[model samples]
Target: MANMNTLAPHVSGSTFGQVIIDTIADLRDRRAQRAVYRRVYNELSAMGPRELADIGISRNNIAEIAKQSAYGL
Candidate 1:
């Protein structure tokens, strides 16, 4: 006779719990990064051509710079 516990696949309680924790952490991190990106983009966009040039950033590259600042990529 097969034991019921042996017949069923084993599922670990800790693994499941860890997965939930990791997911929540990942979501929180993304949200924070998004906030950083938005702030950088908005601040850069508000500057005029001369101001941007003084800082060595071009208006056309504002979005890319914000992305790099927030995501490091």
Candidate 2:
């Protein structure tokens, strides 16, 4: 017969609950990151073309720039 091993106290439902909480936190972080991206994009897009040109960021690269601004990766 195979021995049934019990999970340690830390690995039990308490841990499961913590994992769920961690997942929620991670999701919130991602949501906030996306929000940052959107906000940056909108703000940048509102600038006149000459202003954007002065900054050297093209209109096409706004999304990528926003993502980088949000995540730094």
Candidate 3:
């Protein structure tokens, strides 16, 4: 396996601006994923118990399903 520690950029060659940009990009991606999950969860929660059961989804399974659907699993 490759050693990731050795891949770290040296301080002399690193750019703080790039690091900040990367962090912001990651945060945006995470926010988008959470938004999708929340939407799915809300839709599922709005369904009646019988309706959810007909679709093979239970109230107890909403969280797991939301996560899997959000991440395209």
Best by TM-score: 1
**Model 3 compared with the native: what TM-score?**
0.76
Give the better candidate number (1 or 3) by lDDT: 1
Itemize residue pairs with steric clashes in candidate 2: none
Query: For candidate 3, lDDT tens digit of each residue in 1-73?
Result: 7865343255346577876677789799999999999999999999999999999998999988999988887
Query: What RMSD, rounded to one decimal, does every model reach?
Result: 6.7, 5.0, 5.7
Q: How does each model score on lDDT?
A: 0.87, 0.86, 0.86
Residue 47 local lDDT, model 2: 94
TM-score of each: 0.78, 0.75, 0.76
Using TM-score as the yardstick, the better of models 2 and 3 is 3
Q: What TM-score does candidate 2 get on C-alpha atoms? A: 0.75
Q: In model 2, how large is the Cα lDDT of residue 38?
A: 92
Encode model 1's per-residue lDDT on 1-73: one tens digit a residue: 7755332234444465676677789899999999999999999999999999999998999999999999999
